[model samples]
Target: MRSLVFLVLLGAAFALDDEKIVGGYECKPYSQPWQVSLNSGYHFCGGSLVNENWVVSAAHCYMSRIEVRLGEHNIVITEGSEQFIYSDKVIRHPNYNSWTLDSDIMLIKLSKPATLNQYVQPVSLPTGCATAGTNCSVTGWGNTMSSTADSNKLQCLEIPILSNSNCNNSYPGMITNTMFCAGYLEGGKDSCQKGESLSMDRRNKKEEEGKKEEEEEGEKEEEGKKEEEEEGGKKEEEEEGEKEEEGKKEEEEEGKKEEEEEEEEDKEWKYLMKFEQQS
Candidate 1:
């Protein structure tokens, strides 16, 4: 799996300028109803509408003047669904640390409420923290590759939530309770650079319960079949064990490869930082 670092925004903001989607694809238009583009003269960050009059994003994306464009899919062209509204105020987290990117969240109040429509809607706030290994998705208009320009259309990527221990091991002394990491540890996929909101694909509570019940029933049936097969599978089991040993060796090689890729990715980030500073 590819690993990428992400900052979790809880009732706050995030900031990203000139960031793009890496290893993502174009999403269906208007599928992400809560997605919005934060702009001044140009797109700087991505945000999610919490309500008609407020948006959540990265604190570092704050500017003197920001325009929140709702229902925007293809930002390079005007779709009739777009609603451009200016920011009334921006509130960044007081505890935000730019150096370490701790508590990197912000909120923006819209000058006017966005009109509710099929293309413009608010996202439900998560009631609790997502558990490790949960699947989530991120959408944005950031560049698909490091060397490419920003994508005109919205892009989406699915990533898994990493456990806090694994995250700390990857970032080493940088993760906090307020922050969580999601991405592939093997490299090649990430949320551009910053200012992208991570959203969970939540199911209705009743639907989830029903699905769980079905899964339990299926597992019980499978258990009976497995018991029947085990009595006749001794030879196959031995063969499987031999295959597993080979798999372990392959896994060790893959781990070493991932470590090398992580180093390369770090070098790429450093180069990008130097380029940005010179520009």
Candidate 2:
């Protein structure tokens, strides 16, 4: 699963001074329809729409009250596609550990179902595990760099999934199964310190699914070959056993014939001895 770490903003509603996206560019308007801004009075975290009534976000972003803004491209301007809905309930993971950051996920139920449109839709959940080197992207309104101001426009950064071992090398004893890393090891591109929702590109995800299907097909083929080989081996053993039985039968027949001949000779010799004695 792609994990999100959001830096909660406590200041103004449009505070650009907080953590932001690094090495990212402005996303095409409404390209990320699932992306949503989690706000109380001010924007605090980014989230993704999972369904018409639910949004997924970081657990640490939980607040007593939250407003979810969907179809938002520019945070400052009012886009016709934008839909603002108050959260009816917020459910954070029960096992969330603040220190370890494990199970750092939350779900927000919208007070009303979001109207689905071209500019507002839910993202499909991933079905398979994200492998290393899988291409993905993150989107948020965070700053492009530490030295720069936050962007009002939604920014997206392309990144590759990192192996757990490699991520652990960077933060020893900190990586968890609930977390997976994506970004450059050299530190060129990354999501903003403020939360950016990570997502695997649909194309890449399809490719991964394709690869898995091919692997399963290969395994089935291998199993079939093994079955064929085992059957051939059994047939050969049965043939060998039949041949051995036939050879034993032939030897027994020859022994019986020899015994019959010996008995006939004995009978002839005894008759000859009786004729000589009579002479």
Question: TM-scores of the models, in the given order?
Answer: 0.70, 0.68
Q: lDDT tens digits, residues 44-139, model 1?
A: 788888889998888778786799999999999988999999999999899988777777888899999999899998888876777888777888
Misplaced by over 4 Å in model 1 are 1-18, 204-206, 213-279
Clash statistics: count for each candidate:
17, 5
Q: How displaced is residue 141 in candidate 2, in Å?
A: 0.8
Runs in model 2 lying further than 4 Å from the true structure: 1-18, 204-279
Local distance difference test, each candidate: 0.78, 0.76
Highest-lDDT candidate: 1
lDDT of 2 by residue, 103-131 (tens): 77788999999999988888778766768
Q: How many Å off is the CA of 7 in candidate 1?
A: 6.7
